[model samples]
Target: MDSSSEITFDGEQRIGIQKRSVRRRFQALLEELTVMNVQSVADRMAELNPIEGRSHFCEAVMRSQMQFPQSTNVYAALVAAINPRFPDVGYLVAKRAAVRFREACDSRDRDRTETAAALVAHLANQAVVHAALAWDVLMYLLTVYPMDNTAAAAGFCIECGSMLRASAPQRFTDIVGGFRRLLRGLVVDKPLRRRILKLIQADESMFEDYPAIIYELDLVEAGEQVTHMVSLLQPIDPEYSLDSSISSTSEIAGGGYGSDEEVSSC
Candidate 1:
């Protein structure tokens, strides 16, 4: 094995079968960050320039607010599913979700009572706060790694068969493919398929100000975006990814790391 090749989670799921890998990753992160004070993490997140999928995350938050409009289970499920591998992303998504949810509140608006204005403002502030915490978490980890070294990431541990929070996914063409496949698998409802597709394709992450484009589309039209984006995200099949799976991808034997309490709340 290469010196950098380390054991990470195997794919055996503990909670929901689909969630097992990410759950492991999430637990480790909370443990590691306990010492880092979440407030600092939030500050750093604000300075971040949005990444490729950020706009999508932001839009998803808004759509969740608009669509679900009331239930938080979807929000929690999303956070639970994503926070493991993409904690920063999850935090940002949370912040965005809060604002979107508030915006969707029929009782509140800029023109409404001062109480509504204050409430909306408060949620917006909280969004920024969460974003900062998430950012700090990422930056702190980045500092832990040697400036020139990439192998220091907690990365994946095959022994546990779970993804760990210590590192980000390495560059692989297939990562994009895998993400698309995962998103596709998440779609069951006909409406969800369209939203997922639009999210993948014309979303602002894919194209600037794409949200404007989305508002123009009817639900049926939006569904096509999912398929289009999947093709673009993975122009070729992910056959190569499976065959050339990252060296870090190994199966686990048993126990490792933190309590389930912090991670399981989702």
Candidate 2:
């Protein structure tokens, strides 16, 4: 509360209050954007136009198909909503949030691929497993098909528009399953295959009560990481390439999968 409200100063007091409210509103929007309902939004769009093999997730990713189009206007709105009265908390949060969010998504994709690769070992034919792994990666980086960025989400969107996309699908489970199918087509590594089972059956809440109980959660648990990351990415190194396997799954091979630059317009 500014002292202006108590004194008969210019309406600066009311203006300052409005700015505080605006900052709070902006922060809330970011949180909402983080929980973006990609599937629902895509479904709504499909009602008007259908895209085969492309889910809301894929469609949303496609906006990054040529760089995210600031698909969601949250960033811009936040900027415009900033109160001239108070410090720019909205700008500060937005600038850094985008960077960290991008890192989390990129790390999630890598872990998915690495886990897929490892599952291939458990399969029967090593070659087939490789192909399956490739497909999974293809699906993830599908928006920019043939443009591999497993080590990175290169052209992927890292802007405020990304908030418009849905939460990450459990593509990792599919990737792991696909790899299993590929290897199974070959010979079947009943023994090596055990690791795949261990991972699938393992606890997903590895970051929960007891991380050691990896046998509880499923593969999508990997995606759940973004939620944890939203809070922590700001403090940690966005490029740190966390390889603990327990958290990010893949080593910070390089940088994020996409760039906010791709969707600056949106």
Candidate 3:
């Protein structure tokens, strides 16, 4: 063959080899992701280098969802691996899943709705501690799921709020604002409203500037109840003062009261 033709042939051969190698590696990763054992999948994920494995992790998760559309366990494992390293990718996967859930809800598919709720719940549980991503997922749920699922959506918001209060109080205002905007006109159930109130009460200082917002939502009584509850929970001392400086010091030192507890109680 002429030199020019030989060079072109070599280039084609190199490209072909590269494609095959990528496909093989992807298949291997897929095997690790799809194994019957959840711990095995988690172990393999732990061993992966985040910087190098990010794309592979994304592809594996997307493919896993396609392969096991009904398996919340698989989605949870995949999300748990990706969220800490590539939360944006995790959010994208979650968004797609949410869209699917919305479609199922719109179609009145009971079985599909249940499965979708489970998948979204797993994603929310994995991402709730992450403020930005959690808000995105929570908004998606509130927008997509019907009022029938309002309690679940409210539960997620409470969890997200609790996490933000404990770990990222600085971001609390923005996250709470997002929740307020999304939940403003919706008729939230009494239990859900109570849960939201508890979240606000857990870190009242975070929402101090927005008391009017809470009041306008008809949550004033709930807020008062929380204040009373907190007062009752406090250790009574005649010498103790509710001074701002001491409160600030305590907040700064402990990172916010009840932040270390699980979200269920928050």
Candidate 4:
């Protein structure tokens, strides 16, 4: 090959290597952060500034959160810590989560629905997203799948009841009251009713050990926190395209190191 062609080929190879290395770092860091305590998770997550690989970072966190449901709070905490500096990460996570929740509900998959619901609940608690999204999910569950989603609604209430209540007392009261009314009806099984009631009553203590946003990790101030308004009812584009390799039209120049390629979100 010509000298110029050889030099170009070598440069392309080096760029490809750097991108892969960054992607691996993103994946590994996310996995480690998910299992750590909230405090430690926060401490570690603050080090990340994935402006170039922002979309890849989102993909890693979402994948980890879904695979390990118990670590949902940790993931939310990490997002909360980095959100103020990297608003795109928070926005993408919220959009994907809303989309996931909607898909799970439509397919009648309780497990998936609850998983997505939990992530959204914790995110709301961290103020990464608005509480209205949670209200929409609750209303949808109660109004559309009243019988089918009783358990999901109960779980959502228990997960972030404190935050929801603190944010809007009247709405929180109405939501819980609505659920209680359904339980009193004859249609719901006695055992299920009893179980849900216990969960609802215990809502206050749900976050005692793993609080939604650790005070130390609460990086975003009330005014500075960018709460993305993602409605479950709106036309949500999950930006799944962002998860894949950037095509030529969208590829970042110079191995995608510094450019913040703007990806459209819901």
Model 4: per-residue Cα lDDT over 1-266, one tens digit each: 77767534355555455555566666656645533454454445446456666676776676677777877777787787777777887888898888888888888888888898898998998889899988887777676666678788888877777787777788877877776777776587776687577666665455464455666546556787778899987888877775554332223334443222221111
Q: Which 10-residue span in candidate 1 carries the lowest summed lDDT?
A: 152-161
Model 1 spans > 4 angstroms off: 1-51, 98-107, 110-266
Clashing pairs in 4: none
Candidate 2 residue lDDT tens string, 37-147? 422332232333221111212212323222422222322222222211111222232223334333434565543333332222111011111223223323444343222
Model 1: per-residue lDDT, tens digit, 110-219? 12222222222222222222222222222232343322111111110110001111112342223334435755565445443443344444322433432111221112
Candidate 2, overall lDDT?
Answer: 0.29
lDDT of each candidate versus the true structure: 0.29, 0.29, 0.45, 0.71
Candidate 4: Cα lDDT at 69:
80
- Give the lDDT of residue 116 in candidate 2: 30
User: TM-scores of the models, in the given order?
Assistant: 0.22, 0.20, 0.37, 0.77
In model 4, the runs with Cα more than 4 Å from the true position are 1-15, 34-49, 203-222, 246-266
Summed over model 3, clashes come to: 0
Residue lDDT tens for model 3, 1-266:
77766533355445344433433354465555442454454445545543333433444454455445545445564555545545544544555555555566667664555455555554544441233444444555556654555455555444335444544565656655554654576776677677556655644654343221122112112222110110111232221132232233333322432221111100
Query: Alpha-carbon error at 206 in model 3, in Å?
Result: 28
Error of 1 at 114 (Å): 15
